[model samples]
Target: MAATLRDVTTYDLKLAAPLAAGFVLFFVTPLVILLALSFQTDPQGGHYGLTQYVNFLGDSFSLGVLGSTLWLGVKVTVLTLLLGYPVAWLHQRSPGWARGLIMLLVLLPLLTSVVVRTFAWVVILGRQGIVNATLSWIGLIDTPLKLLYTEGGVVVALAQVQMPLMVLPIITALSRIDPNFADASSVLGAGHWRTFRKVILPLSLPGIVAGCLLTYAAAITAFITQSLIGGGQMLFMPMYIYQQASTLQNWPFAAAISIVFLVSVLVVVSIFNALGRLSRGYANA
Candidate 1:
């Protein structure tokens, strides 16, 4: 009779039980409570129904807030991708020392507190800020352009804060690709841009999707960045939810908006997952 051996991974899987239990205790518990709260017809918890969700869905202004929040995420993600991809590509092509330096610079933003970074942007975008001062010195403008407390300002600040999320994954993806593929393309008479578009880009789409998903989620729900950069006059979903819950003491409606925003984000994430799957197939093909 032959002796049977046990699977090693079975023992390894047991090591993660603590983490799984902790996630259930901390994350799932609060989420379940929030979901329960959202169904209440009033903040007092006297009744339970979909009144809050109905009120939010039926209102035009509420819908606009959600729409604008999603659009803002799109702008920030696009801007970060456009700016970060070049940096990642450069890092991939650089010497080892240069690559290390580039990675350090990319990660430096994450080391600092986000509030500190947002405040730095506030200073930079002020009327007497670096941007205006430089432009004035260059004789480009007679007066300072309005930069602070605007959508443009919020997008710029969020992009800078979130740049690492966009860059790091692309770096990982690019590093995995075989360098010989590029050489083969070149040997086949493909120019640099053509080789990149045909070979490098398809291989990198999974990374791009991951980066976009992360950046989009962060940008949309960034309460501090939105509040500081956009100010009170402009409203996003995060702030709208805050006002309803904190200011007005309307927990049911606030919870409802939170659920709507959460579902909207999940839908966006699912679309990204689909894109990621398609990109993986294209890359494999």
Candidate 2:
């Protein structure tokens, strides 16, 4: 028995070693480099202190950019949740062939390169795009409305891109819920709406939280969609970091901005996790 237990422990360690090494090499090492660089001086040879962070925090323009980035993340997350929940619920209750079709539609965007997807949106939302042509033909306006290079355009593109990530998790949670619960509630004289609100929603909180966390994190870190859709007008944190790092060649300041953005994402994730816990506790109570 002792020999068998020792062998099991050795097997577990062997299985874990490669993953641990990869995590340290790929994720932890880059993060450590970024943190160290954040504390260093920029290319102009200022003293190595908190000068980068101080300058970033003190600048009103930087503050506005941060606010816009964060607000965009929130808007994208909320929009995805609102649209994704019903789609996921319907997919969960769908027949086998219908389920396959829905899943295919959801995952189709993921199969394409992000650059390609953003370009497609550019074509569809551009001034001479299908939408504008249709509106003009129907006499909605004398001229095309400006859709590209705007916040609304960015939000629309991102929500469509990230909707699958939101939907899959909700579908998973809904699938795990037994249909008998709803039936039992109906037999107990509860209406469908009440049963859904009191029973289905509480049970699905875990998936909602998981989906929101993923969607919000992705939206915050997004660059391609924001750049393409907003056409350099929307200055999100990732875009700002890219400009600082690549265009200005200020690696240290860029690193500082990245660290701040990382902290903000972590804080948002923590809040979502806390809300999930509270929801579960209330449901169980």
* Top TM-score prediction, candidate number: 1
After superposing candidate 2, which stretches have Cα over 4 Å from the reference?
Answer: 1-11, 44-46
- Compare the candidates by lDDT and give the number of the best one: 1
The global C-alpha lDDT for each of the candidates, from Candidate 1 onward, is 0.95, 0.89
Candidate 1 regions with alpha-carbon error over 4 angstroms: 9-12
Candidate 1 collision pairs: none
Backbone clashes counted, model 1: 0
Total backbone collisions for each predicted model:
0, 0
Residue-wise C-alpha lDDT for candidate 2, range 222-283, written one tens digit per residue: 79998889876668899999999999999999999999888877888899999989977876
Candidate 1 per-residue C-alpha lDDT over 157-225 given as tens digits, one digit per residue, 9 for 90 to 100: 999999999999999999999999999999999999999999999999989999999999999999999
Which clashing pairs does model 2 show? none
The residue-level lDDT of candidate 2 at 15 comes to: 72
Residue 280 Cα positional deviation in candidate 1, in Å, after optimal superposition: 0.5
Error of model 1, residue 66, in angstroms: 0.3
- Give all TM-scores, in the order shown: 0.98, 0.93
Residue 21 of candidate 1: its Cα lDDT? 96
